[model samples]
Target: MVEIKTPMLPSNKPLIVGKIDVRVGDHVEQGQVICQIETAKGNHQIKATEAGTIAEILVEEGREVVANDVLMVIDEQGKIQPEQQSESNKEILTTVPTDTVQHHLEKDLLIIGAGPGGYVAAIYASKRGMDVAIAERKKLGGTCLNIGCIPTKSMVQSAHLFELLNEMDLFGIEGDFHASINMEKVLQRKDEVVDTLVSGIEYLLNKNKVTVLQGTAHFLSDTEVQVGSTIIKAKNIIIATGSVAASLRVEGCDLPGVIDSTAALDLHEVPDSLVVIGGGVIGLEFAFIYNTFGSKVHVVEFQKSLLPMLDADAGKFIEGICKEKHIQTSTSSKVISIKQTVEGEYIVTYEKDGTTSYTIADKVLMSTGRRANTNGLGLEHTSIKTNKRTGEILVDEYEQTNVPHIYAIGDVSSKVKLAHLASQQGCVAVDHMLVGKHPISDTNVPSVVYTNPEIATVGYTEQALKEQGIPYKVSRFDFSANGRALTMNQTEGFVKLLASEDGTLLGAVICGPDASSLIAGVTVAMTNGVTVEQLTQTIFAHPTTSEAIREAALALIGRGIHQ
Candidate 1:
């Protein structure tokens, strides 16, 4: 007989047996998963080193085990001789239990988070007359309302107002007056906004009669979960744990002056100078915010362009805008290290063009993307599948996992991490479960980046079409020629529309004032399959920002009324 022992894990702690995939008397192949263990990081699979037949199981599910602990006995020759079978082996085989029933509270649906995805699903399911219970370890509105979207946008509005005030002379208002910013009040107002929204969500949940359980949820079985001491069993379960900010692995990343997006939102005061790593949406938004507030800001991006996912022309236009605002940007750069000096300043070392350079600042914000929060949810307890590389849960059009009744939504399963998308996905999942069928295409989702001049896009991008080899035509209209934009003195960007050879509207890209709100119309048009000719025929108010959209559509058919 050969012994199958647990190997050393990444975290050197006693791991609990999460699942067993094999049973006694079953033949196993080499490197086949026999079981899995739960650790501090996540689940780790235990595989057989050689082909063998399972003779005995030494550990049961939910038992704590350490390194080199014998998990099972496998007979290499596919059979255990009577002389080789000892009393201990027979006792082990006899003592192992196949299953156990734990006491649990019954419900119609159990949602495993209180974020946008979870709460939305609970409320929708409850409205359909299902007994729904939601478990959350933190606030009701999750990261978006509390820290991510609403808070940052509030700060952005403050910075925008400040910018407008600085240009009062251009608006024919001459004054010998000055204004100053008090970060304390700014933070207070942000907190107030968050609190009001959170209270509103709480009221909605109460009105819908959805039970709110305050605790962390762990799956004890496919249909059962334990939230603190209470066990919840439901016919359907939705996992929507959201995501956490990813961290850089370089040295000194954990220093006092270094911070993440969450820490950046709660700063007591803006630093004299700031170094932002990663030139993505979060990084650039904060860079513009701090720069508008009179801080020397520098953005470091590893890619060749800022907003690499956007159209190349749009990204270059924004880069020029950043330069005009005196915000420093370094593209095609890699950060090597960050160190603190004796004077309490941070030195960021990076490589560009095969040359090393350094920049000093009072604080460093690590705005590197985010990772799905799928770890530690006990996913191995069920047949639900996840991406091995990104740890994102795998789901179908209806957000249903491999297991029919189990579902995943939001950052945990979606490729797009926006909160609004999560809320929409939640509604779709509820419709699929209670109603007959409701399909929502992810391609119809819109994306927005709220900067000085916001950027928004919906439908297929130029790069995406080129990659897919789809024949397309493009039309462009500069906002500089739009009467409303020129009148407001905000004519620094343009609008571009993409359509198929047959004149079908494929997508729209807007890079100028109110792009966030303007994209809503484009999204609605695309969702309803509105053609370019139809859009051009629709009347738009004269001298308005939306006229730019109509102009672009008209230009597609060579009938543009404006430049």
Candidate 2:
């Protein structure tokens, strides 16, 4: 028996463009308005392009419909006319038996989650001739794509663009410009980027012949995982389930106006004023974006400083910048309770310096930190253990768990929560499985904060050296001294370097324009164990922001050319 599938469309002939109106299995007659196509011009009524019951609507409403794409199908007395491409179906009709073409489920390596880590493991392991299977609970790409990093970054980009336009006068560009964000459109573009990338991941998984399962994964035992009751046996398993936003426990914490960092990304309307709880990376970054977007942002952090792991001086620099942006920041301010007002606002009560105070805002964002999603995975059934305080899985340098056959490589295990670290760990874990030795450490990994000026750091902080009793010399270069920064009118931050007494490069912090990109060269140097002398020896492009790195390195030895 042959099954036919076709996309339903309007009979307007020239084609009316709008959102899809009919759903799958919706019966339709000739010339019926089956779907609404939204064109940039406006919505257009799409009539039934065929005379039959509606088989399916492949796309959703509010989504643009394109020509030649399968919109839906119709069946006239079992004679199916599929409007979409059917070449693959014809090939299957000619050369393959349905029973014979069934995919065998056995795999040598099975990974759970397809975020940065899991997908990388699947690709790398598959390249090494391992049969790979990846199970994801939702979309092919995990939280980073579907909810967290990608979406938030896109919003940040938009906010930054708005900021740039607002400051165009500094560049001697004169124009009367006014722009307002359409929140729905901003979110639509983010969704588009995520959809494209997630679909790309699906393609890569299929190209690698990795069996993709869509369901929750659980450990059936040490060497096996169960996904939707399907037992997948493998020689080894990699658990890459990532972290989620950590919420604080306080009165009225579950109020409707309160949201996590991820939830803030999906908000339809921008709040008039937002109170951000926790001044960590996530909180500050969002605060910068929202402040730029015309929201009155007030940040409350329990710690005395922002980004506590960063250098104290660096934190001060960020505080200064936040002040310049008119963002209200309070450190050592602990929230005691959250109450919902009759006006639908959130009243946040807090104590600081032994005094209780309160503030009201349309919304409160919880950005304290993230904890690993280890619950409900049935890990208690196995010998694997997790840290009681943080719930992070215990893993050796080789990314191996207590059971040799199981490996963990992500927020589920490591201190570094960045996505790139997870991808690298995934590769290292696979290599350990194949090579039987060698492992990687979280040390020397570069961390970047995507705030206005952008902060990127790598290796040891000066505090770390002091704590470890490692003798180190400190050096610095200010963007105010750089010719490029002077020209760009962005001389607001500096680069600081910490090196050993013997001049071995230890770590560096960059806080300035293009800091995210500028740190890559320094990161590469640190990763390759390059020395300060080697870094200074390499000529940097003159009048470029990157030359600051070289200048900063030269300052370590007290011979910087510019400073």
Candidate 3:
């Protein structure tokens, strides 16, 4: 079997399909001129490379197609193997020199980069009955599944298990337990989890009949994209190429022992001592993971507090947790240089409070931040707007770019580089395209950090409210007083809620056991305008961590069941 695809014109725009010399179910001999196309250079004939029967005619005579757009499919009389259909499509040529054409049909939508944002939007759009096609050059489930979220969480689980081995006595369980991690097995398990999710994405895409194009995609035109040998044209396009791990512009950053978050996840073995630069989400997450894995981990940050982007109290609270976990943190510090020693240790130099300092470690990780991956996307030729500083595509509240039909979601455009936010933005963009109205507001988006006790926050932070001088009531319910937390012996952080004077739920931040799961209820409340009184009145099972939320609500109302 072979595909008769549309060859490109002199330019990458759509070619006007002209004369059609063949029809579906028609047998044609070799060297037959099957169709003619109107091209930018001139008119040209599309020919059959070998004798074949036309199994499909995907385009009308008056339709338009770009190069590598599939115009027809042919049974090549066994001359070409079915496996070579792809190569045959690539080989099909137009009469002109600069362009060739071949493709089955145009899609209603084309999404570039199959990351969380792209895949989620793809599935959602498919459910909306849109014929979607997604192009992923590498793995199916971009960074979150393959490198960022899933892998880091898997490592965290193993590290937590190892950390627990030393604290068994605290739980009233006694054993002369000795535990160690086989890094190979740990990495193998992470890969297994990632592979399963990636395969699941493929299954969903296939089940939805969305064309899964596997190649690095480049924009051919505002409405057309080229992936490998195929040029795909769609009514709408979404760019969801997620960000990549960026490094610090310091000396010796590219040295052998220096690594990024992705490299940090797949280390051959946990280093005896590690220096993590940047106190942001990525740096701190890895810092805690390696710390629990028995590595002497130290974090250096340019900001005044850890997680500088989050609330001040959240940073301070997590700082205390880091200290309790023995993970050294150096804030208000800037990494100046990293030099290697013959002894195989790296001496990291930084300046803090106008003083120079140094630390030695077996490995140095740069978790500074990520840059927008817009290079080689061919956006330079288009009028699509982008952020001048970050180079990320600039989208409106509806997730639509200045170019109406091109939407940018996820890390490619978002200021907040979170997987869930990306997924949400994706759905919003799809909804905006189909219905011209987005159903959800991004204001109540929830964010969680997978720390020891976890940190989850939704809606406004206390700092933002204060800075804006918003009238709000605040209450903090310490987990120390919660029966469930006390019984679980994991009471460490508190549940804090901010509400309006009249009792409308304004914001929430949790830093304790089940924080990740507990934040969902708080987010729902804040999103749906659940008031403090209503939340307190809502039935929460006794002795459950969720009771802490109701207690916090009660505390905000001037009288509390327990404080």
Query: Could you tell me every candidate's TM-score relative to the true structure?
Result: 0.81, 0.84, 0.82
Per-residue lDDT for 311-379 in model 1, tens only? 777788789999999999999999999999999999999999999999999999999899899777988
All models: lDDT? 0.87, 0.82, 0.86
Compared with the true structure, what per-residue lDDT tens digits does model 2 show for residues 339-435? Answer: 9988899999999999999988999998889899877777876789899999999999988988898999888898888888899999999999898
- Poorest lDDT segment (10 consecutive residues) of candidate 2: 1-10
Prediction 2 TM-score vs. true: 0.84
Superposition error at 58 for model 3 (Å): 41
Model 3 Cα lDDT, one tens digit per residue, 379-424: 9767798889888999899889999999999899877888999999
Q: At residue 543, give the lDDT of candidate 3.
A: 79
Which candidate leads the pack in lDDT? Answer: 1
Task: Report the poorest 10 consecutive residues by lDDT, candidate 3.
Answer: 93-102
For residue 298, what is the lDDT in candidate 1?
96
Poorly placed runs, candidate 2 (over 4 Å):
1-104
lDDT of prediction 1: 0.87
Which is superior by lDDT, 1 or 3?
A: 1
- Candidate 2: Cα lDDT at 305: 94
